[model samples]
Target: MRVVVDGMGGDNSPQAIVEGCVLAQKEYGVEIIITGPKEKIEAELAKHEYNKNAITIVDAREVISTNEAPVKALKTKKDSSLVKALDLVKNGEADAVVSAGSTGAFLAGCTLIVKRIKGISRPALAPVMPGKNGPFMIIDAGANADCKPQYLTQFAQMGKVYFENVLGVNNPTVGLVNIGEEEEKGNDLTKAAYQLLKEEDINFIGNIEPRDIPKGKVNVLVCDGFVGNTVLKMYEGVAETILSEIKTEIMGSFVTKIGGVLLTPVFKRFKKHYDYKEYGGAAFLGVNGICIKAHGSSDARALKNAIKVSKVYYDTGVLEKMKSAFAEEKDTLKIDE
Candidate 1:
C-alpha cells in the first residue's frame, strides 16, 4: 500500500511530517510520498538516518496558508503541497492522502481532485472514538455546516458501513443527535431525520442527546456539520480543561502533592482514555479517495498513526463498500421516483 502525505501542511511541517513518514515506512512497510518543497523535505530526511528508498518526494513549490478561504485557496493555489498530494490520489499514484493543513483547504482539494462517490450527496468526516462498549463513530464531525434530512440518513448509512467493515462492528446501532431522547424534542431537521432513521432497516436507536455521548449509549451518531463540530470541539475543550485543572490541583500543595503521588497511576490511566493522539486522525468519507485530517498540533507519533490508519482504511475496502451500499439505496430511490 502507498500513502501520499502533505509535508508542509502541519504546524511542524517538513520536520514532523518527514519524521513520521520515516517511522511509518519502517513500521507499516508502505511506500510514502511526501509533497512539499523538495529541498526542505530532503534536508529533513538527511537529519534522520533511515532507509532512503522507503520514501519518495513529490516537489511542490507553493503552499496554501491556513487563513485562506477553502474555495479561494483551491482555485488560486493550484500547485500547493496539499493540492499536489491530493493530485497524486487523483491520478492513482497513491492509494490514500493525509494532511494536517487547513481543514477547509483539505476538504476543497479532496472534493476537486479526488471527487466524491457517485450517488452520494455529500462526503462526511467520520471519526471513531473508543467507547465503553466498543468503538463509536460520529459523522459530519466538522464537515457540512448545513444539511438536509436525506443527507443525514446517508451519513448514517455511510457510518454504518464504516463501523462494520473498517471498525469490525456488526450491524452498528445508529442514532440521530437531538436535544432530548423524545422523537418530538428537536428541530424540524432532527425530527425528520429521526423519522427517516426509524423507517430505515438499519439499527436505528432513536435520539442521542449530547449528555448521553459519554455513557457510550450508541455506536454511531449522526448530525449536521455545525452540530457535530460543536459537540466534538466542546468535548475536546472540556477534556483539555479538566485535565489541566486536575494537574494543577494535584501539584498545588504538599498535601495534594502526596495525594498526587498516591494517585499517579490512576491519573495516567484516565489520561489515556482522553488522548486525541491515540485515534490518529479524522477521515473524510464518501470522497472517491482516502483523505485524513490529522490534528494541527500532532507530533511525529500521531502522524505515523495517521498513516497506519490510512493503511487500515485501504485494506478494509471502505470506499468501495460505501459506494455499493449507497448505490443500492439510490436504486431504490429511483424506483420510487
Candidate 2:
C-alpha cells in the first residue's frame, strides 16, 4: 500500500519523519510518499540507506503551523505539506495519510478534503489506549465537543466496527462513558444515549464509569468529545505523573535504589505497556479515506508505528467493511436523519 506522510508537520519535522518513513518502508515494504520541501526531505533521507524506488518525495513548500487557524490555513495554503499529503489520499494517488502535525489542521483537512463516508454524520477521533487487560478504544476523543444523543450511538457503532474488523475482536463489548453504571446516572445526553444503544444489534454493555475504563473489560467506550478528551488527557497525565514519582522515589535512598535495580526489568515492561508510542496514532474514523494522526512529539519509533497502522488498515480492508456495514446494517449505523 502507498502512504503519504507530512514530513514538515511534527516537532522533529523532517528528521524524525524521514527516519520513520525509511524504517516503515524497510519493515513493512510499503511505498511512502513524503510531502515537504524537497531539499529538507532529501537531506534527512540521505542519512538512511533505503530503496529510492520505494520512497518518493513531493515538494510542498508551504506548511501549516500549529499556531495558524486550521480552517483558514486550509483555505489559504492549498499547497501545504499537510494539505498535499491529504490530497494524495483524496485523489487516489495514495492509500492513506499520516501526520504528527497540528491536530486541528489534520482533522479539518480530513473532514473537508478526504470527506466522510456516506450517511455518517461526522468523523470522530478513536484512539486505542492501553488498559488493564489490553487495549481499549475511546471514540469521539476530542473531535466534536458538543454532540447529540444520536451522535454517541453512531460513535458506538463505528467503534464496534473498528474492534470487530481492524482489531479482530468478535462481538466486542460497547459501553457508554458515564458517572455510574446505572442508566439514570448521567445527564440528559447519557440518559438518552443509553436508551438508544441498547436497541442496537452489537454487544452493548451498558454504562461504563471512568474509574473502571482502564480495566479494559469494555472494548469500546463511547462519549461526547468533551468527556472523551477529558478522559484521554487525564489518563495520559496520571500515567506520566505516577511513573515519574516512582522513578523519583526509587532514586531517593540506597535501599530503594537497590530494590529499583532489582526491579528494573519489571519497571521497563510496565512503562512500555503504558507508553502511547505502543499505540502510535488515533484514527479519524467515519472518513472516506484513512487518516492516522500521530503524536506531535513522536520520535522515529512512534512515527514508524503510525505508518504501520495505515498498512494494517489497508490490509484488512477496514474501510470497505465500514462502508458495507453502513449499507447492510443501515438501521444500526444510522443517526436520526
Candidate 3:
C-alpha cells in the first residue's frame, strides 16, 4: 500500500517528514509517496542513507501556511503539499494521506478534494488515547463545533466499528460524555444523545463523567466537538502541568532527587501514558479516503508512527465496515425535526 506524506507542512518540514518516511518504509515495508518541492525533498533524502527505491516524491510547488484560511487555501493552493497529498488519495495513487499541517486546512482539503463517505453528514476526527483498559477512541475531537443527538449516536456507531477493526477491541463499550453518570445529568444535547445510544445496537454503558475519563471508565467516549475539544485540551494541560511539577519537585531537594532517580523508570512509564505521539496519529473518520492528522510538534518517530497507523486503517477495511454498520442501523437513525 502506498502512504502519502505532506513533506513541507510541519515546523521541521521536509527533513523530519522525510526521515519519518524512510523509517516507516524500513520498518513497515510500505511504499511512501512524499509530496513537496522536488529539489527540497531530494536534498533532504541525500542527507540520509536509506533504501531510495521505497520512497518517491510528488512535486507540489506550493506550501499552505498555517495562518491561511482552510477553505480558501484548499481552493487557492491546489498545488500545495497538503492539497496534493489528499489529491493522491482522491486519484487512487495512494492508500492514505498523512499531514501535520494546519488542522483546518487538512480538514477542508480532505473534504473538498478527497470527499466524504456516503451516508456521512460530516467527517469527524477521532483519535485514540491511552486508557486504563487500553486505547480509548474519542470522536468529533473538534471536527464539528455543534452537533445533534443523531450525530453523536452516529459517532458511537462509527467509533465502535473503528475500535473493533483497527484497535482489535471487540464489542467496545460506548459512553456519552456527561456531567454525571446519571441519565438526566447533562443538558439537552447529552440527554438526547444518551437516549439515542440506548436505543441503538451499540453497547451503551450509560454515561461517562469527566472524573471517570482518566480512570478508563469505557472504551469509546462520544461527544460534540465543543465538549470533546475542551476535554482534550484540559487533559493535555493537566498532564503537562503535573509532569512539570513533578520535575520541579524532583530537582528542588536532594532527598527528592534521590527518590526521582529511584523512580525514573516508573515516571518514564507514566509519561508514556500521557504521550500523544505514542498513539501515532488521529484519523479523520467518515471521509471517503483514509486521512490522518499528526501532531504539529511531531518528531520523525511520530511521523513514522502516523504512516504505520494509516496502513492499519487500510488493512482493517474500516470504510467497508462503516458502510455496512451504518446501513444496518439506517431504520433506527430516522428522526423527527
Model 2, residue pairs in steric clash: none
Cα lDDT of candidate 1 equals 0.86
| Sliding window of 10 residues with minimal summed lDDT for model 2 | 328-337
TM-scores of the models, in the order given:
0.96, 0.97, 0.96
List the pairs of residues colliding in candidate 3: none
Q: Which numbered prediction scores highest in lDDT against the true structure?
A: 2
Model 2 scores a C-alpha lDDT of 0.92
Q: Rate the local accuracy (lDDT) of all candidates.
A: 0.86, 0.92, 0.87
Alpha-carbon runs more than 4 Å astray in model 1: 333-337
Over 4 Å off in model 2, which ranges? 329-337
What are the per-residue Cα lDDT tens digits for candidate 2 across 110-139? Answer: 999999887788789999999999789999
Q: Which candidate order results from sorting by lDDT in descending order?
A: 2, 3, 1
lDDT of 2 at 324: 78
Clashes of each: 0, 0, 0
Better by lDDT, candidate 2 or 1: 2
Of 2 and 3, the candidate ranking higher by lDDT: 2
